[model samples]
Target: WAYPMQPIQSAAMSGIGYSPIGPVEGTWVVGFFRDGENAQDPVMLGTIGGIPQNFPGSDGFNDPNQVYPLSNLNFHGLGEPDTNRLARTIGTDILGRDSKEHPVVTQKLSTTPLFDESTGTPIPYPGVPIESEGGDIRRIPKALAEGNFWVEPPTDAPFTP
Candidate 1:
C-alpha cells in the first residue's frame, strides 16, 4: 500500500554568530520520519543533511579563507529569546538527480515551524532534559541507542553513535 505523507520536520543548527561578533556560515539538517511508535525510527522516510546557508551579515563564512569548516555553537538562546536572540531559516529544498546525473534543486516554503513558548515541556522523544531524573524521555534515548524504537540495522545509518 502507498500514500503521500506529510514530511515530519526536524532541524539542527551550527556556527551561529550575532551582534558584535560577525556572522559565520551555518548549516542545518532536516529529517522526515514515518508516524508511529517508531516515529523516532526511520520508516523509509529519508533525511536531508548538510544544507548550507550564511549568517545574517556574511556572504559565506566570516573567514572564507579558513582551511576547515567553522562551528558556531555559541547561540545560547533556545528558551530564553529575550535574554539571547539568534537568526534562523525555514523552508524546503527538494534534491534529486536529473537525466544527466546532475543534482537538481527545488525549494518550497509552506508553514514555518514555530516553537511553543507557552509550554515548558521539553520534546519527550529524543532524550531527557538532562535536568530531570526519569520517564520515557530518559528511557527513549537509551532504547534507541540500543535499537529498540526502530528495526535493527536501520535502512539508513544511525546518525547517533
Candidate 2:
C-alpha cells in the first residue's frame, strides 16, 4: 500500500483528526517511492486529471481491472479533458477568450441518453453558504411533490425514478 502525504491544509496532528486520501483505482496519481530505487513503498502526493487517450485495458500501465472509464448509454468521457467546468466560467478564465457559461440546473439536463424529459433530470439543486467545501447537487425541499421529477433511479428503488 502507498503512503499518502497529507496536504498543509489538512490537520494531521493527533490521531483524532485524520482524513484519508481518496485517490481511487484508475485515477492517475503523482507519487514517489519511500525506499528510493525500490518501488515497494509508494508515497503518493496527489492524483492528476488529464485527457484520456484511450479506453482502459486489462494490461500494465493502465487500469488492470478495466473498471474505470465506465460508459453510459451515451457518455464515455474518453479523450475529453477533466477540467471542472465550475472552476472556470465565462469571463473568469485567465485566457481572454470568452467561453459560454454553464446552463441552469433545471434546463435540458443531459445531452446523453440519460437525459430524462420527465423530472427534468439534473433539476435545480440546493447550494451551501460555505464555498470551500464540495458536495453533491441536492434537491430542494419536497421537490418531488412538484411532479414529473423521477430521475436516474436508485438500484433498490422498485419503480423507475
Candidate 3:
C-alpha cells in the first residue's frame, strides 16, 4: 500500500517557494515470511508510500527536490512486533502514509496464488520446515497452564516480534 504525502506548507519567506517537507512520492514494498516457508517465499504482503527521504531540519534539508531511497529512514523506532499495529494506525503522518486508514488507496500487494488456478505443484524451499496450519501460531495460554503445551519466543530477530 502506498502512502502519498501532500505538501502542507510552503516556505515562510516566499509564498510560492517549495514546502521542502514530508515524504517523497514513490512506492515501497514491505514483506513478511515464515522462517522457512516455501511455495510463497518472501511473500509480497503490502506496499506503502510517502516515506520521508529525510527528517525535517536535518542535514540535506535544503534539497527537497532530491529523492532518496526509502530504506534509509528510521525503521528502528517501529518498536517490536506491534510495530505493525503502529504502521497501520498512523496512516498519514506529516510525512509517511498509514495503512490502517486507507485500505483502498494504499493498494495491498500479495504473492499468494489464486486458489482456483491449476498450476505447478508448490515447491518447498530447501531445508525449510512447513507448519501444518495457516493461522495464529501462538500457543493457548490456558493450554500452557494445564501442561498441555509450552510456548517460547523465537530467538530469531524477525520472528520475535
Best by TM-score: 2
lDDT of 3: 0.28
What TM-score against the true fold does each predicted structure earn?
0.18, 0.41, 0.16
What is each predicted model's overall lDDT from 0 to 1?
0.28, 0.37, 0.28
Summing lDDT over every window of 10 consecutive residues in candidate 3, give the lowest-scoring window: 128-137
The reply for model 1, stretches above 4 Å from the true place, is 1-67, 70-87, 99-101, 106-109, 112-161
Best candidate (score: lDDT): 2
Q: Give lDDT tens digits, candidate 1, residues 14-67.
A: 212211112222322234466666678644332222323432344642334541
By descending TM-score, how would the candidates be arranged?
A: 2, 1, 3
Clash counts per candidate, in order, are: 1, 3, 4
| Reference-based TM-score, model 3 | 0.16
What is the TM-score (0 to 1) of candidate 2?
Answer: 0.41
